[model samples]
Target: GKAVFDATRPDEVRQFFDGLEPFDHLVLAASGGKGLGPFATLDLADIGSGVDEKIRPQLSCLQAALPTLNRSGSVTFISAVSAQLAAPGVAGIGAINGMLLTVAPILAVELKPLRVNVVAPGVIDTPWWDF
Candidate 1:
C-alpha cells in the first residue's frame, strides 16, 4: 500500500488485490501514526502521494480478501492514543487514529465470524525516537 489513499476510490484499491487470498491474521500499521501536525494542507497529488498511495491499496487488498478470509481469522489495526487524547500539533494523527479506531469496531461487527480489533499504543520507547 502507499502512504495515503482516496477512500472514495474503491476500484483503485480493489484492483490492487484482485488475486490475493485472505490470511488467517492481518495486521496493519502506518508510519504516519506518529507525528505532530496542524493537519498539513495537502492537494490531491499530496494526498495521492502521501496517504492514498499507502493506505488505499492495503485497504483495497483487505476488502478484496474479506470474503475469502478464514472463518476464525483476526484483523488488527494499529492506531494511536491520539485518537482519545489531544495534544498540540497532533490534529492529523488524532484524526487518522480516530478513524481507524472507529472503523475497527464497525469492521468487527460487520465482519462477524472474523474478529477485528485495533491496538492503540501510546508513546513508547522506539528506535524512531532514539535520534
Candidate 2:
C-alpha cells in the first residue's frame, strides 16, 4: 500500500512517518529545479528555493522515516545526472543534485545495516517538468 503526503512540509513528513508501521523500503523522488540557468543571471532566491523545495523535503522525509524504516531495507534517493556534468545553464541544478550524490555514501555508512543509495539518472521527461 502507499500513502501520499507532502514531504516539503515538516509537519506532514512527521505525521506520515509517525503513523507508519515497519516498512521495507523508501524511494525518495522529491525533485525541484527552480534555478536552471546561467549562473550570472540566475536569481539567488531560486537556489534557496531548490534547497527548500527539493533538498529539505527529501531529508526531512528520511529523518522522519528513520524509526519506521526496517534495518534490512533500503532507501534510494533519485538525483540527476546534471550533478555529474559541466553542462551550461545547470550550475544551480547541478549543485543541488550534487548534495544528494555527496551524502548517499555517508548515509550508507551512518545508517549501517540499512542500505542507502542514490541514483543520478539522465533527464527523463516526466510530468514534474510540466511546471
Q: How many residue pairs in model 2 have overlapping backbones? A: 0
Model 1: per-residue lDDT, tens digit, 16-111? 445456559867653432344555552324333424533454455567657666869887777778778867666655665566677778888888
Per-model CA lDDT versus the true structure: 0.62, 0.89
Specify the highest-TM-score model's number: 2
Instruction: Give the clash count for each candidate.
Output: 14, 0
lDDT of 2 by residue, 1-131 (tens): 67788888999899999999999899999977587889999887887888888888888899999999999999998888888898899888888888899999999999999999899988788887788
By summed lDDT, which 10 consecutive residues of candidate 2 come out lowest? 122-131
Q: How close is candidate 2 to the true structure, as a TM-score?
A: 0.95
